[model samples]
Target: MTTAFSLAPLFRSSVGFDRFNDLFESAARNDSASGYPPYNVEKLAEDKYRIVIAVAGFQEQELDLQVEKGVLTVAGGKRDNGAQNQEKDNVTYLHQGIAERAFKLSFRLADHIEVRNAGLANGLLTIDLLRQIPEEAKAKRIPINGQQVLEREGS
Candidate 1:
């Protein structure tokens, strides 16, 4: 009989990850296209964030943005030509890089984080991110006095 290989180690490590691992593992399955729709995540102000996506070929009517169970999903299908093909000039090869493709991009959101605003301007689609500070997570200092407080044992 041949020696047995250990798949046990893999399961043991995974158990330690718990919820964190679940989120991590789920992301890997569909994270092959993080750069799709060409977006940017930035902290606009002290407590504000912004996500901007470049959607040159997608129209406002053709795009969909939804928030479900703490996930922000942005999906779009190509609009009908929109006179772009009529102006398609396959001439001098300076650099032709912009893709005329239809794609969908998703972002995993944390608790209290919300999509504040979204707009498409010029050829760029901007999605603003705002985090609603929860009462427990917000900054609050505890007053401490240098004195021995009474302690109660479990009843």
Candidate 2:
């Protein structure tokens, strides 16, 4: 049994968090569709992250990664191997466990987060992410100018 949560109270106290509320609602609705293609997210450094996904039977050409408007998407599909089609009549599986169906997964990225690189090795797809904060956005000391001005007599 899953317990449902309401975001009504959060909306009352939080300002400018509409996107977060929407994201939470969407996640709750799609919780049932998130089991395939297990993955792990790790923080490598202060602003660096890595996402590793298990893709045992998938090839490099069959996987796709895209980032748009602060959203990252990863998709995979199985291509028809020539041998599998030719030997379909003679092949039989008593128990098939590995999933070959197409799947799409999406992740919401914070501002300034970028996908640095991606690679597939030993059935694991690794995606590197970097959070690059702009120079203006970084914290800096503000110079305070001290000056005194004399007011003129009432005219």
Give the residue spans of candidate 1 off by over 4 A: 1-30, 79-98, 151-155
Local distance difference test values of all predictions, in order: 0.67, 0.76
Candidate 2 per-residue lDDT over residues 1-155, each given as its tens digit: 99997764333211222467666565556655466788877778888888888988888999999988777889999777788767864768898788767888777777778899999999999999888989999999967677645567893
lDDT tens digits, residues 1-155, model 1? 89987543222212112356655556445455555666666667756777778888677987889988877788888656646655564356577686657677766676677788899899888888777778988889978999867677883
lDDT of 1: 0.67
User: Model 2 lDDT vs. the true structure?
Assistant: 0.76
Clashing pairs in 2: none
Candidate achieving the largest lDDT:
2
TM-score of each: 0.64, 0.75
Model 1 weakest 10-residue run by lDDT: 9-18
TM-score of 1: 0.64
